[model samples]
Target: KLKLSLQEKKCSIEQKDRAISDLSMEIQLKLNEMIHIKTSLSGMSSAKTIIEAQLSAALSQITGKDQHITDINKELTDALTSIVDLKAKITTGEDLRKKLHNKVLELKGNIRVFCRVRPLLADEIVKNGDSDSILHLNILSENSIELLKGTANCDTSSMSGLKSRGNGAVEFTYDRVFGPKHTQADVFEEVSQLVQSALDGYNVCVFAYGQTGSGKTYTMEGVPDSLQDAGIIPRTVTHIFTEIERLKEHGWEYQIETSFLEIYNET
Candidate 1:
């Protein structure tokens, strides 16, 4: 009886030991699962922080670009506004031009027109064998003579007094005072005075009009070869320069620009 009782006690101790071991193994498994979940959560938090930082940086760069674009747009707007205002103050050839023209006419200023003829060559006179060739002899045919006479007498009703001598010499004088003889400086002087008048708020136009081969170009432009043969253009340009220099003495300033244009016949 005593031996049997001892064996039963030993078996009871062994079962207790097995239960403790099983409890320890279950606690270890629960701790391991908690650690794994904590690790996953930590990784997710780090990834979220990195994404937020990148997003914030990208947003800042985009904002800066937008601000730059806004500044450029503002500058362009200001420039356009300035251009509009400047154009508003300027005048063109329309109602304003007509008003200016009327005002100029009211001043009763008359621009002088002068005519010059080149002297006939001595060889032509000798070839004609007429010492009187210089006299009232007409070089142009009758139609041309009539045309020239008409042009000359158009402004004034009186024809120039013409005296034809028996020796073929002719003397002619107009009723009004004649202009200074044709010189290289004549056109420049006349045009320069008109140009200077612009400072006094006057508009001026300088141009040439005449029949073909009538020295219109010669009078407007000058002969470049030599001073004796120089025409109107060079002389006037010199006059203009001198006038500008003279103007500096006064309290006047000028900015000048030149433009050239040519017209051609229709195709």
Candidate 2:
């Protein structure tokens, strides 16, 4: 009976040992599984951190690019403004220069005299029929005329002796001179500036003086109704009205008065 009890105790001891070993293995397996889970979680956290850092860097770059674009836009706007200001200044400078030029012309005795030579009429050409007669008159420059006294009766007492000594040509100088070939339009071009002076607050008068058929009437009043054949008077009227319209932008208002007077024989 003692042997049997000892055997039973040993058996019990072995069974308890087997149970403890099994429980320890199960605990080790659970610990390994927990370790694996922890390692996986740490890796996932590191990946998340890297992704967040990349996202932050990308946002910063976008903000910086946006700011740079804004600065470029501002610079372009400023440049355009400067260009507009420069253009305004240039316009003002041009206007000032024109005003000063007109003032200088006014100070230099704007009452300038221009001489025009009348073309020979068909009747006169038939009467003279001499080509050399045309050569007697010489156009020296745009402002000078020379009348050659070639064995012809010429009134030279009033001349200033500016001619060549042997040629006996009386040289006459005026502010401007027009040749016989000059058209009505050509003459009005020079007279237009003088007409503008009247609009600029100046008393202006243009007169014609010569022999009966010396183109005085033609210069003052061309083919009456024709626009292309209009004279200085009509052209001056047109220009004055046009300038009045143009100067409205500069705050200029004008009143024009008309006067007609005939002073034949200095009456």
Candidate 3:
């Protein structure tokens, strides 16, 4: 019986030792799971912080871009306004120039005189063997003429009756003088202002007075189809029509009348 009791005590001691070892293993496993959960939570927190920083930087950049766009819009508006004001000022300046030009014409007699020398014709050149004979007519200035000796068919007595110097050279003054080299375009420029005056409700008359074959017809009437060589009448008509079109923008309408009458030999 003593031996049997001793064996039973040993058996109980061994069972208790096995239970303690199993409990220790279970506790170690629970500790390892808790450590893994903590590491995961730490990584999540770091990611959240980085995301917040990026969001704030993005917002700041958006605000800066919006402000730059607003500034550009304001600058564009100002530029457009300045352009409008400059255009208005330019229009005023043009009107003032026209007024001043008209005033000058009124002061200097509405009927302006301009002299033009005709080029020597082919027949005249053949008749006068000396080409230098045509050079006897000297253009002293834009408003003066000097006819040297032997150029005009005037005697000394006849020249004295007129304004002639002792050298038998005659000098005449006029409002404007054009030499033989002046083109049809050049002559029309001087007459254009007068045509403009007529368009502005003023009566204007342009006449040609010279000997026969002195380029009067050529100056008054050039080739009808040629634009560069167009005379004063055609150029004036073209200018009037163009001005009418331009003035249409300013609420202007016009009705033009046409009339042509020629008197030959005063008949």
Candidate 4:
């Protein structure tokens, strides 16, 4: 009976020992899982810090761009204001220039005369039935004319402008004279300066006096759309309008007024 009781006790002690070993293994596995969870939390915290730093940098960059835009806008507005002031100054300067220019023109000549001789057309020769015109007019100088021959005999002493050279030929003097060889541009070169006098607030008078069909129309109104043959009226209009357009950039404005009247046959 004593030997049987000892064997049963040993078996019960062995079962208790195995149960303790299983409990120890289970606790170690639970510790390892806790360590893994802690490591995951640490990694998440580091990532949050990096994200916060990147966000701060992005916000700072956005603020810098906003300031730069503000500065540029202010500079643009100031530049525009300065341009306005400059335009006003230019307008004042233009007024002063007009006064000075008028004074200079007054000193030069209040009344000036210019003459342009016309070329003989082929139609005129056919109508007259002769290559030679009846009157022999010759240009002695830029401001002088010599009549080579004339049917009408006149006393030189009676005439104020005529000077007798020889053989009934007489020379006349004027302010300025252009020969048939002169082009339309040649005549306008002198006239363009005179046109400016009128713009400077002066009473200007320009007239043409010659026999019938002697180029009065051609000189005043050149061929249409022909730059080379542009007449005095067209050129003067162009000059004034171009000056007006140029002044507009400087804040100067102009109102154009035009009048036209032709006196024909003493009426």
Which candidate leads the pack in lDDT?
Answer: 2
True lDDT of residue 207, candidate 3: 80
How does each model score on TM-score? 0.37, 0.58, 0.60, 0.65
After superposing candidate 2, which stretches have Cα over 4 Å from the reference?
1-98, 130-133, 151-164
Q: Is candidate 1 or candidate 4 better by lDDT?
A: 4
> Model 1, which residues run further than 4 Å from truth?
1-108, 121-181, 186-192, 262-267
Task: Enumerate residue pairs that collide in model 1.
Answer: 135-168, 135-169, 135-170, 136-170, 188-236, 222-231, 223-231
- What's the ranking of the predictions by lDDT, best on top? 2, 3, 4, 1
Q: How well does candidate 3 score on lDDT at residue 27?
A: 84
lDDT, model 2, position 79: 99
Against the correct fold, how does model 2 do in TM-score?
A: 0.58
Off by over 4 Å in 3: 1-97, 130-133, 151-163
User: Taking the candidates one at a time, how many backbone clashes does each contain?
Assistant: 7, 0, 0, 0
RMSD of 1: 14.5
Tell me how candidate 1 scores on lDDT: 0.56
As for TM-score, the candidate ahead, 2 or 4, is: 4
Q: Which residue pairs show collisions in model 2?
A: none
Which window of 10 residues has the lowest lDDT sum in candidate 2?
151-160
Error of 1 at 151 (Å): 18
